[model samples]
Target chain A: MAKGYLNFVLHAHLPYVRHPESELYMEERWLFEAITETYIPLIKYFQKLVDEQIPFRITMNISAPLITMLTDDILQERSLKYLVERLWLAHKEIRRTKGHNDLNNLAKFYYYRFVEQYKIFKREYNCNLITAFKKFQDMGYLEIIACPATHGFLPLINITPNVSRAQIANGIKVYEEAFGRKPNGMWLSECAYIPELEDALNEFGIKYIFLETHGITNANPTPIYGTLAPIISPKGIVAFGRDLESSEQVWSSITGYPGHPNYREFYKDIGYEADWEYIKPFVAKSGHRVDTGLKYHRITGKTDFKDYYHPDWAKEIAEEQADHFMHSRINQINNSASKMVIPPIITSQYDAELYGHWWFEGPYWIYMLFKKIHYNQDTFELITPSEYLSKYPNIQVSEPAISTWGAHGYSEVWINPGNDYMYRHLHAAAERMVYLARCITKPTEIERKALNQCARELLLAQSSDWPFIVTMNTMVEYAHKRLKDHIGRFNALADMIDKHDINEEYLEDISYKDKIFPNIDYSIYAK
Target chain B: MQLLKSEYYELPAKYNQTVIRLLVQSPTRMFVYWEVSDETIKEFNKNNQNYSDCTAVLRVTNLTKNYSYNIPVSPFANNYYIDVEDSGCNYQVELGRISKKKFVNIYTSNIATVPSDHPASYDLSKDGVLFGNYLCIGNKKRLKIYGNKEQYSRFQNQNHTAFENRRNGSSENNFLGSSDNFIGSSGNSMCF
Candidate 1:
């Protein structure tokens, strides 16, 4: 008998970065890179498990922003263009590295990877990855959850009245529009949580949510079984806490599988490493260098002089690590179950992009991990939260502490001195949005359009991505610009609404530009 | 109309409203950002005879415990990060001027609730064991407990080498900076 269960939750999210005004903004590549490296690779592996008839149940949260981008015709077309360009670069690398055996082989590997993923993107899935995820959910192998519209950090945004409610309502709306049914679970933005958030989750019929380890361990009345058992909040929503050991094993770059020497180093991309003029065409439209996703070297230790990547070695290590992971879980469950009355459940949640984007061999690690668990061990079964709840419906009632999966496990990462200036603007805009929604009981078509756009702008501004990027110090310029753009557009819309002079032209342009949540009702903020 | 230029997106300096907003950052810390409109500042100085002797201060009151402290701040800074001693306490801050140790109210903020830093010492745990065919949740509703017993038979263990020894290499070389902690290392996508 399986002693315990392992719930692997992968949260896939990217801030909506679509610019119809510019052909290829450097920032747009964030989505394109995620699609190419993370989403497609994950889809291919999921398809593999299905074809082989491996009985696996995995939980995935595809954020509303990612879904909107994936389904948009422009992004789909742009993704194809991005893929074809990488293919072109890979093709060129094949000829360029002809004399060298290791570089040549790695180049060919990337060429085939791009080729296969391209076909899967174009032919199999028809350019919409959401459909692929939906099909998996229908097959009962995956449980896809919803996220806040635009991936706003709920804890801080909740300060503005009804903002969190609107975020939740619109998040579910986007989920239903994409997945054909309401979501059973929600991956809280950044796994951030507060007790009051349960009211919103319960209202939205979200049966369960995932929180950080301390959020559970530090709950009121104190969780008896610690993070091993899912606790039901006072409001009846179940909460799953991340298992620290499992998280550290996979997420710690210093000790995790991604930091292994054999894997392809994420940093050493060919775009910057190659001769400038030769790789310029594959770079950004602004002629600035960007990651072309064609890396030729392995991590090869902490040194700058990297060894040529060996895929065979990385694959062998991934399988070995999978075996190690399975055994570790078996040992952990064996040790924990002996002490506890109920079987312990270890929940491991990670950002889905880490798999293939940041950690080059991550998706393969997951693939191998699942395969090993299926054929090799019986200590723990892979279970989703809903499935676990179905088996063990009655849960301990406790209120979770306020928490997030950020540095120091709090709001410091999102609301520090670096990005604190934006909150006043966000709060003011949200208050105005609520006011507008309440006062404008009846409105013309353009007025309604402007109001709905107002809500969208506020939601986009509340995204945790902007402040996070500002604090992280990578791509600070783009983050500043996005926050400024959203807040600015929102104020302009509010001004036009107040003056009773709805500038149809301005509204039309922004409506098309920040066109997310097409069916958003401005009335969500009215309450 | 052409698209709004990037410069148009610059956020305004302040809304013309006398308001104080307090946000809970963590158990031990709270953030206070307020905008006192020019008129409100003028009105305060005009009304007060000892305006020159007044000091701008953030008077943070812990509503749950009934205690308060004054944090001296620069009025021109417009915002301050206030550290609190208590977790799981309701706190409110008033941004005002203090003259001769007397606080003159300007704008009181909405109550900010700092979540509990530690679990409640009061144990409310009940037996987690499945006692019957159905389990009741706090007299709310009864749910049938299926008790997942479907288990795979024990299989032969495969002999696989542990990969930890292979991780002897230092992570000094990289584009994305390396971190010793898991949350610190999560990539640009904000995994944590």
Candidate 2:
């Protein structure tokens, strides 16, 4: 019998960054990059695992906004075009670096990667990632979970209880419409949880939720298993806490596997290293420097000086790291197995983007890990949250405490003094949004359209990424503009409704710009 | 609960809205913004034909704790934004007219929670940051990673600056323009 279970969860989320007016918006590149790097690599690995008949279970949160972007026609077309351009660039790189031994090989590697992912995007899923994930769900290898609409930090958005309620409701609605079934679990925005959020989760029929470890261990009645077992809320919502030990083992930069000198360096890219004139057309439209993801160097001892990347060396390290990770988990499960009434479950999760985006070898590491575990592991079984719950129905009842997975383990990173200034605007807009949603009982077609547009603006405005960017001090200007623009749109739409002169031109302009939640009903917020 | 309408006010069709809102700025500050449309303002002026003392009364209620406070708004201020000092309470704002010391309630905003800086907003948490350390909060307790000694020492050498930054409390501690703690050189595991 397996001594313990290992549950791997990947949260795939990106703030809705669709700009219909301008093609090639800098922010929109986030989606395309994640698709080419993270999403495609992950899917390919999972597909190989399935082909090999390696029984595995993983819970993935395809966040509402990311799903919206993935399914977006314009974005799909843009992603394909983006991939072709990169492939074209890679072909050029191959010819330009023909004489140089290291650069030529690296160029070929990138070319094949881009080609494979683009083929997967077009040939396999028909340019719809939702279909691919749903197929996996239907096949019982993966559980596709919904992330809250717009990835709002629920603890703060719950201030207007109805806003959180609407978010939860809308998220599931989108997931169900896309996947043809309700989600089994949800990845909370920032893993920030307040006690009242469980009621919303339970009300929406979300069976379980994953939180930062403290979210479970800090439960009212302390859980016996700590982060090893799931805690049940009074309302029957199951809460899975992250295994801190396991998480740190993989995520700690100093000791993490990705930091191995052989791995590809995330910061060093051709976009910055290459001749600006040569890389201009391939970089962002502004002709400014941006990561083209064509990294030619390894981490190489953490210096400004870099060494030419060795693919064979990186592949060797990836396999070793994967083996090392599996052994670490086995050791952990064995260590905890003796004390638990039921077999322990070690749950580990990370940002899906971290795999192929920041840590380029991450997907390769994951593939090797799964492959190593499939034939060799006998001590642990990979299981999904739903699978674990099914096997162990009875759980310790406790209400989780308020917590987030931020640096200080609270809302300070997001709600600190620097970003606190916008809470008032967000909250006020949310309140007025609920009022607008509730008040419009009888409406003309235009009135309904305007109301729906207002709700869209509210949802877009509530995204936690804006505040996060401000606090993180990256793209602060863009973040501020996004927050202000969304709220500004919401308030302006409200004014139009008040004046009883719905500006068709203005409404159409905004409607075209913020094209998310196509079938949203304003009544979702009417409590 | 009926609103008093004046003859001069041309209220929009189905014009029943009192743009009153409450936003939690921090653990201690609640920001309020409310606006009365032109039609409503015109109606209010027309109703006060004699122009007796007409003041806007802002009444705030903390529904979570069942506490309430009534603050007077400046009559001339059509657009008002005020900051109330409080936290950890679910609040609602009501705008009313005060004439001859009799209040007539006009608009009530939706309830919004004044977010607490005290992250211990849980029944299970006895005090401090968490619910009793069952799920365990805080990144302070990092388990010693069992890895190759060679890799560990190499990593330690590279991260010496991070440790130095932490000791000095310079860029890492500063929230302003400090991407050091957020992006590069920091290993804060994103808990999203």
Candidate 3:
């Protein structure tokens, strides 16, 4: 029998960013980049593990917006175009760096990676990642979960009970449509929770949720097992607190294993390194260089100079890090088991993009870690939250302190000054959504489409990424425009509903653009 | 959609007199955002209610179990620091006008529970429009130096020193965002 359990959850979320109007919407690259660099790599990795008949259980949140993007034909085709351009660029790079052995190897790495991603994207999965993830779930190797309609920061947008309720309700609709089953758990956007959120989760029949460390440590009465045990709320929904030690080991960019000098440097791509004229065709229309995922340098040290990255060295380190991580977890679980009456379960969750997108070696680390834990461990077993909860259902009943994995461990990241002004607008829009949801006394088919589209607008605007991006100010104009445009659309639709003016042409235009949840009911927002 | 347990979300008292709503901001704070409507203000005016005499009396009632409270606010505070001891206890709040020392129910909020920490911890919740500018890896600074010069300059000019402060682990006025805070941000207020 296993002495303890370790639960790994990867949250895969990207804000809904689709531009049916533009052929080269620059910001849409976030989705394209993630698809090529993050999502496909993970699918390929998991496919290998499954083919070998390895038994593994992990939870993933296939957030609503990501599902919509993965299923859209335009994005699918655009991503394929993006991949083809990458392939052309990689082939050119093979000759460009023919003499430089290290750079040539790096170029070849990207070339084959793109080639394989193209195959997996087009043939294996047929360009729909959601279906692939759904297949994994159907096969019982993966536990797919849900998230808010557009990953709205619930504590802020949930001003009205109905507003939050609608976010949850619509999210469920999209999840069931994509995954073919009701979600048993969900990723609270930003992991931001208020004390009363359990109320909403229970109402939605969600069984479990997670919080950052303080969320568990700060429990009314300090938890006996700290983050090692899940806390069931006074309501039945379970709350898993993130393991700080494990989260920190992987989260630190400068000090984490990914920053080791042997690992490929995340920033040193060939796009910027090569001659401007030579790479112009591969560059954006604006002549700005984009990351080609063809980095040749290693994160040597604090200095500006870097070394040529050795994939052989990086894989060795990844293997060592995987073993190191598994042993540390084994030790932690064993230590906790010796003192605790029940088996201690440590939950390690991270943004799924971190694996292959940012770290590059992250997928290898995960692949190796699963192997090391399976073959090299007797103290701890890899488990899912559902498995742990069922094995030990009688848990301490208390309110897991309200928290999020965001900046300040609270709602400040979403409600701060730079972004706070948006709230009054957001809150009012939510109020209007609830009002229109209930007030549309009777509606024809056209009016009903307008109302449902209005619900989509409000839900899309409420995505936490917009405020997060606004606060980050990385793509300020884009984030700002997305929030305003959605609010503008919602307001226009609400006004039409109030004035009894239904414009089918306008409705069809937005429906074609912000087309996510077609069958969603506006009545979900009814208070 | 199957009806949510009517009791789970059903409002306790139908509040129509005032546009008053309560939010449990944190563990120890349950505050209401209220705008006494024209009718409410007019009614108060007709009844000879003065600003000094109108106190926002918050009433907390346990909807699930049997428990309640009537706490008086000091004349003009929209925020209430609640002391309801039960964690995850189901409760609702109502704000009223204490006219001539008599409690007058003006508005009530949807069912909510007190947060898990003192509301004072949220002093920084509105500290500033904190721009969180860091992700787990490949920040703008490196992106800039690595020769994505165009986008780098654009992102650099757009963000502030807060992101820099965050990465340095300074915990300065930046109020927190990513990297160090991603792993953990130590605070004196949490239960630990």
The two-chain DockQ for each candidate, comma-separated, is 0.18, 0.03, 0.04
RMSD of each: 12.0, 14.8, 16.2
Q: Model 2, range A451-470, lDDT digits (tens) per residue?
A: 99998888898898998999
Residues A241-298 of candidate 3 have per-residue lDDT tens digits of 9998888889986567778788878888877888888877775655688876667888
In order, the TM-score of chain B in each prediction is 0.59, 0.47, 0.42
Indicate which candidate wins on DockQ: 1
Q: What value does DockQ give for candidate 3? A: 0.04
At residue B105, candidate 1 shows an lDDT of: 90
Model 1, which residues run further than 4 Å from truth? Answer: B1-7, B42-47, B50-53, B99-101, B123-192
**Alpha-carbon deviation at A54 in model 3, angstroms:** 1.9
Better of 2 and 3 by lDDT: 2
Ten-residue stretch with the least lDDT total in model 3 chain A? A390-399
For each candidate, how many residue pairs have backbone atoms clashing (under 3 Å)?
A: 1, 7, 7
Determine the iRMS, in angstroms, of model 3.
Answer: 20.6
Show where candidate 3 strays beyond 4 Å: A285-287, B1-114, B117-192
TM-scores of the models, in the order given: 0.90, 0.77, 0.78
- Fraction of native contacts (fnat) of each candidate: 0.43, 0.02, 0.05
